[model samples]
Target chain A: MALQPFTVHRGVAAPLLRINVDTDAIIPSREMKRVSKQGLAAGLFAIWRYTEPGGREPDLNFVLNKPQYRNASILLSGANFGCGSSREHAVWALNEFGIRAIIAPSFGRIFYHNCTRNGILPIELEAAVVHYLAEAIQAAPQQNKLLVDLPNQQVSVAELKFSFTIEATPKRMLVEGLDPIAMTLEMTEQINAFELQHRQRMPWL
Target chain B: MAKTLFEKLWQSHLVEQLDGDAALIYIDRILLHERTGSIALKSLAAADRQVRNPDEVFCVIDHIVDTLPGRGDETMMPSGKEFIQTTRSAAQSAGIHLFDIDHPKQGIVHVVSPEQGIVQPGSTLVCPDSHTCSQGALAALAWGIGSSEAEHALATKTLRINKPQSMRINFEGQLGTGVTAKDMILYLIAQYSAAGSAGTVIEFAGEAVRNLSIEGRLTLCNMAVEFSAFTGLIAADKKTIDYLGGRPYAPSGENWKQAVRYWQSLHSDAGAVFDREITIDCAAIEPMITWGNSPEHSCPITGTVPKIDSANKKSASMQRAQDYMGVKPGQKLAGLPIDGAFIGSCTNSRISDLRTAAEILRGRTVAANVRAICVPGSTPVKHQAEAEGLDKIFIQAGFEWRESGCSMCFYAGGESFGFQQRVATTTNRNFESRQGPQTRSHLASPATVAASALAGQLTDPRTTQKS
Candidate 1:
């Protein structure tokens, strides 16, 4: 896919769904077998849906079971979001699930990087704001909307406007569609210049 | 300002300052495994580049190989098989030492590296697997990198790094009976939350750390990634030297003496400072198990789940965990049903781990409802376990004895649990869907896993042991 800077949808609200959302929870571990990112979306929540043969023992208690959350694009979660293994599959699963942004008080360090690298925006907000959004979603259970402006670092739901935070480096990379690899490769000219100087000095190249 | 251990190491590794907040750091060694290494090697080939120092690079086929099935079988997906083949070819073509499938020393990359003494004190190590930090247990500075970064490291023997702050975690008091390093780390993660060590290199110290065995130290450092720490380390000492003594790559005789002298000096100075400090009373910790999807959502095996309402009310993430884990407030974890139990992984599949499990299962049969398995970490570990009849004990106790490799953990390639099946596992990470999609994994030590397998639930090993 060609790299493109796409604007995030503004004022698109969804109910707060899924709890203890770990990286693995987003995608099943079995799906990690594939080296490349393909056919992952089909099994995004496979464990929740089909662990037992003939699907005799479906876990209705899982968040993915609730039909209302079938297409929610924005996920408002509890503290320490995406904790556990640093599988980037969690980010891929969330992207496949159509979740463009995650609003939480904090995130596991590795998960945050995976999200930013895959064009998923992880917004760190105050606990009060997260609680407010979660409570509002629960109360309405139907009409919860959120307005997220990445450029302004603000998330607005109902009458409350909560500012979010992102480190300058990750923010720049996310906004510029630059992953770590892309960022490093962007310095090709400098690297090439250094290599040329070294070759001339040592005759090794 | 006082310099933290991280600062000292970063300063020592700096080849030059590249720009603001970035530096060109010399990497002493790089380790690679089948899964991520294949991609990195492919990228290098695409760029028409060769490794700068093939001797310094090591390759091991672990993640994708089947631990239950014999070697050469294609149990993994087609792509996984392809990755393994590519890694084998790339290692040979690049003149890098390759530990192919079923090699006596082949096993979890992290476990094999330290066992073989490829990981030495004061060196900078990088791998594409997140658990690469496990090598930090040897007092080597190590961290996980992305495929692209791995490729770069291979080509230049250097990596562009941004230094991290340092945190010193000190534990006092003797650990109570039945508590292992796994319990200690679980307690730390639960108390500090998963983000507790963010942007920091954690240096474990104090009496408890000092008393742990080298293998125990490895278990403690292996899960540093669970807490989001950049890395975790314990300074090398006599115990470290003892463990490295006759390993394959360890220096010999005069060189060994010189190396020991240098390793002994790697400890933090008496007045050395850290960016943050946290202390724990090791005696207070009990055998712990994760109640929810995240490792941070853990509590003592005897304790009840935290009330959802009592969770950080401000943190939606905690509240969500309370809801998704299907755990109710005031509910004890003692009698929770488990569908499976696993004992073995890079984290706890060493000879000591097997001996502990075998001792616990000597006369008991696994619970009728619990399907259990014990996988050795490497071929050598398996051979040792069999020689001591540990595998026979496990099989007699209703546990499947499997070959050596990264099995069931990280879904590298092994049988997965049924959806929502509660599993008491000795491997690291209990994240949502970690064992399989929607499968609930509870992290514990090998002894605890054996005990739970017998009880068919989350049970403490201390209660079941006949001292």
Candidate 2:
């Protein structure tokens, strides 16, 4: 249940150019009926990738279906990626499908939180930079492997270097592989103190 | 200090102020559904973590269960029964209260929360389901989160979240006839695309908004997610307190008085600043319906489906939605033939929704060409409808009278209409194949669904003739 450490991720980047890529399309609701987190690897983008019920035949036109992008580990998506649905399965699907880092202009708030918790590094970059990277990836996916260095907060491809910003807590968590609950537990005293004040200030029922 | 309603509730519940924007906020209540909440609890159990406060948690089996009468642990979906059974075991193990399929009070988590008075004004609640924001209608701070967050809340009774910026959407003027809260929300989504309110919690103000019933307010907040807002809130007032008074789980005696006094204070102070503000004239709105996959791809019922201008077809999704919907430019939204009609889902399956549908279906019959289904939102709503003979009207009109649960809201490989069946439905979310494979669903109000069922097409509810 603990997250994998994310330090320096280098892999081929696949471009999903569509904006507002909702969690449903990432992995539809029907595929999420499984209660356990296991068996989720196949459900990642099942609708877009699978031509049949169990993904017997791959959809050739889909990016993931292309042989070159089959093992891509970096996803260069358009703005507002992972919108709609609070399902963490979206992040699970992305991670299970071999995507370690996602570079987008923006992300849904819940999806961004889930990405952090699930150990999938979400890099928020400028729209123009994301668009440029997406084109670069699509043009030469095999030759252009993106190097996402979390400690340095930089992503580089061939000759282009883009610096990104992430909050301190999430950055440290990703770099050190620290558990979020463990971090929160360290502030138990502060939490209890606040509760004591809150209850005394306003206690009705 | 002047404070907006959001800030008042937020500061009241703030537990540990973390670095920058993040904080550890305490949660008063949590409502869990069978679909996603079960996964969170199961993972916690697997991790050997204990629920911090079982009394604060309430679980219900709504999402994956069959809505058919005389149903049990069996499910139509492949291993769908596992999700329900797993949740039953997980809730029991966690010592959290479970509302099983046979529980009289069981219903959609959002409907059951306020209906039972468990979600009081000024409270903060979260659920794994996105529509958890519906509880915000009662002036509560509620929003959706992922299963992992649910697990954390179960284990800690707190969530570490960055406080969102605030926005106020004021609906001024008066609502016209035949336009309900569903229409108002649809109109809002059409005006502001789905992502308009991203990273913000919206507080709806203005006279027209306050004029809506509590149920209508619930319906209004139900689609806040469609606008990409973290949640939607309305300040609690006399109506909210009166609505909560004497409910099953509401406070009694001295507690009731103190709770009411506190809830009465849960309003935005004058001159409180918000990050953004917008105003909509309610009189300018009309009964609206979705024409494409996205909720924003909508228009007034009388308006035509838009053909994207040649210069405006840049967003492939818009063009793709129009093509998938099979509606051309200049196509009339009304009178488009439908093969089925659904009248349920947490979005619009409350008692008022059933009554509205019954009014349109009093003596009429569903078209022979259309398959009409009506699933009540909750067991209590179903019982109340039956007591009032609303069920008789629907049954007499040939609508399938179903038990309470999320039936075909989004077919989880379970019971569904025929493939590619063009249907008008009351459920939210018009995404491609949401209800069933290739199913073309036109999102509308319950009355619109009823009238459409009768006409075997998308007919304006206001224009439906009396039998």
What lDDT score is found at residue B248 in candidate 1? 90
lDDT of 2 by residue, A61-174 (tens): 888889888689988887668877788888887887788999987887788888888889999987779888877776678878889999999999889998999988778767
lDDT of 1 by residue, B288-386 (tens): 988876778889999998765545442455555556566677889888889999988878998899998899999789999899998888778888999
TM-score of each: 0.84, 0.97
Measured with C-alpha atoms, the lDDT of residue B56 in candidate 1 is 81
lDDT of each: 0.75, 0.86
Give the per-residue lDDT digits (tens) of candidate 2, residues B173-291: 99998888999899998998887887799998898889998998999999998888899999998899999999988888887888888888888999999999999999998888899
Name the weakest run of 10 consecutive residues (lDDT summed) in model 1 chain A. Answer: A196-205
Docking class of 2: medium
Error of 2 at B344 (Å): 1.3
Which ranges of candidate 2 are over 4 A from the true structure?
Answer: A53-55, A196-205
- Regions of candidate 1 where Cα sits further than 4 Å from its true position: A1-20, A38-77, A92-103, A116-121, A130-165, A171-205, B1-3, B47-50, B76-80, B93-95, B253-255, B310-331, B335-337, B410-414
Candidate 1 iRMSD, 1 decimal: 5.9
